[model samples]
Target: MRKNKLQRQASTIDKKFLLLSLFLTVVGLVALADASAPLAQRNFGDKFFFLKQQIVWAGVGIVLLFIASKIHYRLWEKIATIIFFLSLFGMLMVFIPGIGTKLLGARRWLVLGPITIQPSEFLKLTLAIYLAKVSSKNKKLAAYFVPLILALSLIMLQPDLGTAIVVSTIGMAQLFVSGISLIYFASTLALGGVLGFILIITSEYRRDRLLTFFEQTRDPLDKSYHIRQILLALGSGGLFGVGLGQSRQKYLFLPETATDSIFAIIAEEIGFLGASILIIIIVIFVIRGFAIARASPDTFSRVLSCGIMSWIGAQTLLNIGSMVAIVPLTGIPLPFFSYGGSSLIALLIGCGILLNISKYGKE
Candidate 1:
């Protein structure tokens, strides 16, 4: 009887959710192929260099997504603490002299021979799982706040303010869904806001980013150059766009064209209308994710699903919001659209787990 029940659940995974994830991933590859051509050619003498690597990562991500989907969602609950610590340890490994790779002044990647990964990316998912597990068991405030603060401190030490923000957001979202007291939630938010402000004012680059956000005309050729170019690309694509593969900005005009700023390239080539369609699809995907959370069979799965959706939604908002000048520039990549293997793989695995949880959700 139990075997039959398990088989039924496995056969009933959320198809809409799975299909949307795959669709966004495919669209991301198409956009990356166009956006990275010039940069790849100039840097590596091969126009397809970045695209080829991303395609390989995508293939791996898809396989993991399926494997994760097959695994029992409750498995994470049992090993949550172990994996969380392991991921936290991975973040620490990034600070080890020869093992850590420092790029653009940030020590955020672990380099083992030819393989490079940003451990902070995996930390986001692991932290979520751990928090959900503990919270579901009715743990105390110290249980949640300690791990949350420890993880955030390490990520900030890497000086990755963008990822720290995302991780903190994920932690807070899970805490909120787990039914923490309103007073504590409010206090946590206030504390986070105060700490964020202090961190920004104390850091030269962060202070400059904040200042440039408020005063776009301050340093057109220096601090604000990236945002200026982004705005130019956005304006160039009035309504229908200049058409795909024809973005002027992608031709060395935009910084981080294939990674953090890929969305701008998509907007430049596909226009406002096409960008709207992409945004709509993302919105639908997130909505379905929440629907799965709503139908989740238990508190752990429900909270975990919520955390995953919030992670995707918050990251997307930060990336696109920066592109449109709605918020200060955060060097976070768009989910599924970014060109990094670590991020893509981590996200797919999260989605896969979510799909597994959906199988046990109320029909």
Candidate 2:
């Protein structure tokens, strides 16, 4: 009877984590409605265009979250290798002539019938699963390192430096948690940094971004325009904010107002105080996620939980960091808040998996 009761207790889903996920999703929708209004009106003749699409995706994502929570967490471990390969294949699909959609000199999305998706976004989650599985079974760094390099190579081919960074961070985080040698981890970190610097210098546009970051005052109207606008919005929000739904930057003045730079809009509307509160909530969510990982009953669940939280934490930092000009703009969307179907759906599914693992955690 004691064993049975303990098992039952361990099987209960993490309600706090689930509610926090839903709250972020709902808050994202609210921010999107306010941030994308002008852009939607200008492009589609409907103010709620992006919000409507996001609402549908949010609904789909929430349903997946619950379904994923109910499924056994070990199921992913059984098929991690297969799904990781599928994710790689999906990345390759973006290079196909008829299916791939190229915009602004980057081939990052695929259009299938009426639906479009960014394979790299899903690649992040799949890679994390595969890494977790490999780490749990093998202690050797190369066991997971080879696949990490392969996935990073494929993503870099898409020329998405931002996502490549996030993916690499995810892999490295997993490697660390898997108890790899500190010397090997440090060596890899140094190598990655050197390679990243080389990549930046070799690409003209990327180099320009680096230079722009250093010389923000050089060209206010040209290369620095985007960052300038972002800073302006932040400045406008001063303390309390300009009031929600009244952001002037949303009127086509800020680039990626609803996507990569939505945080600025949020800061502009709610001010520093409101933005800080949101940040605090996100921090709490991450802390709770790690707590679940710490309590996991097996190595697989523990590593998997850590991977998911790392992905969220790394991406959130990148997005908000760039918005405030603390880091160079990387074109990565803020989780939940950014307006993209692939990102939102994949994230929610990952959260669901985390919730499932939480249920199996030791009391």
Candidate 3:
């Protein structure tokens, strides 16, 4: 019986999901090394500075992934509340003097001794787990929406609108998977839309981004330079590409080459063919994730799985959409591919949980 049980467990693991994630990680590391070389040398005096940091984070993320996968996922249900509050506390720390680090006008990182963290990333993951655990029990908007609003408010106050949007998307996806009524979902979406519009208009910089996205003004160099540069990078690669490690734009022609605009650099270097392959890989990841969610043996696992998939899907849409000029620039990072220790680590751990859930899925 024990041997059969072990065999059952082994057979149930989602190899497809695991393989796709590994593929993306390998692709991300390769692309990042190529994309960050020039900037790393200019800023840090080393061609591989950013690449080395990312490799270190990747190692740390792999270790966390193993631990999160080994821990029975149900324990997340027991400690979800504590995790959520701790995430919120971390968010608050971003405002503390000397501890909070500001970059590019946003105070989104907290320096805790030797380490720095972006709490919004942790908030996105923890909130998904907490909502999955609670919404599975309560099944009401009042039960989950209030805390979501509180979390969003805190995140937005950090002026990290991109992370706020991602967290909200995860919460709404969880609500839908929990069987919330259509009217309720519709109402929630509409309310969110109105609130988003208000937030965008109230901030001068956000308003400028919105305007730049919709209609280019007299000065392209001021507000819309980034978008125009992104278009130039993408368009320069007509069919195949300029060739890997040969991106012209990476030589100070474009900004954020290693972060938000990394996809554009990918396109510039590898052309449409390579970009399409990356997109196809992401599509496979999302489909497998939802399939695992559908096969989950319990409500909590199913809902959590849905939330995690939505988190990745929504971020992908935002990041790619902005790159192709279909949406405004939001400074959102492309999953696994973007250069950020916090994002990659949080995402890998989330994948670990999803993998653990897959083992218990209905075969």
Candidate 4:
């Protein structure tokens, strides 16, 4: 009877998490419909093309999440190391000339026959699983000093500095949950800050982005075009916005209107009020996620919850921050609001894992 009661309580808690995930999924599709309509209509002669694709991806993601939620979360522990190594290989494979396809200037995607996928997206999920599993055992190191440095090293190699930083933070959080010394944690933060500074200085493009952020008006037509446009969109959004699907910027006025800077586009069309509502929804989702994490029965699931929460929450912040020029352009999509099939699937799978964690949570 006690076991049954515990299981029922867990199921109830999990339902809340599921509803939150579903909320984000549905809202993302609706936003995508607005964000992708102009470009889809212009290119495909159909306004719903991208929206249809988003809906399909969302469906696939939900299914993937369901499967993940049903399975025992411990299975991830058994294969965590293997999964980490596989993702490492995938990250390395992105640099292999023909096998690795470089779009723009970054060689970040791999082509596997009909599928062209971003390994970093998968990296976010797998790294979380691996870190959670590994740290769940070694209480001292996991809670102490290893996670921030070790995990950050692997992520930085991808040259995905933003993700590397976020992943490092996630690992550190897991360590903290495991009971780390706060003084050492501060030192780790300082070290990461210095390393990030060094990486930014050594990388010319990143340096330019930092400079452009400060002097956007100085080079309005040059390196600062995207920054300037994103700023205009946000500024133009006013309080009530210009109205949905009526964004003047989407008429080729903003670059990556459907991808990286979609939030700015959303702000422009829907105004501050609409953006506030969206932010509230995301905040509620994050709170629910943390609730599930805290309510979890064991250490691994707690760490798992932390990892998953960090991945989605961090990515959302990076995407929106980059769009608004509060930070450098990370080129990351706005969660479900952006247009990437692989990204959507990976994210969904991660959420599913979280749902599973909630279902098996402790009393």
Ranked by lDDT, the better of candidates 3 and 4 is 3
Worst 10 residues of 4 by lDDT: 142-151
Candidate 4 runs further than 4 Å off: 10-13, 41-47, 140-155
TM-score of each: 0.98, 0.98, 0.97, 0.92
lDDT of the candidates, in the order given: 0.93, 0.92, 0.89, 0.79
Model 1, span 1-363: residue lDDT tens:
978887787689899999999999999999999999999999999999999999999999999999999999899999999999999999999999999989998999999998899999899899989988988996689988899999999999998999988988898899898988899899999999999999999999899999999999887998999999999999999899999899999999899999989999999888999999999999999999999988998889988999999999999999999999999998999999989999999999999999999888776
Instruction: Sort every candidate by TM-score, greatest first.
Output: 2, 1, 3, 4
By TM-score, is 1 or 3 better?
Answer: 1
lDDT for each residue of candidate 4 in 92-144, tens digit (9 for 90 to 100):
88888888887777767889896688887887787788778767787566343
Clashing pairs in 4: 297-362
Candidate 3: misplaced stretches above 4 Å?
1-7
State the local distance difference test value for candidate 3.
0.89
Q: Encode model 3's per-residue lDDT on 284-336: one tens digit a residue.
A: 89999999999887889999999999999999999999999898999999999
Model 3 poorest ten-residue lDDT run: 5-14
| lDDT of candidate 2 over 114-151, digit per residue (tens) | 99999999999999999999999988777888989898
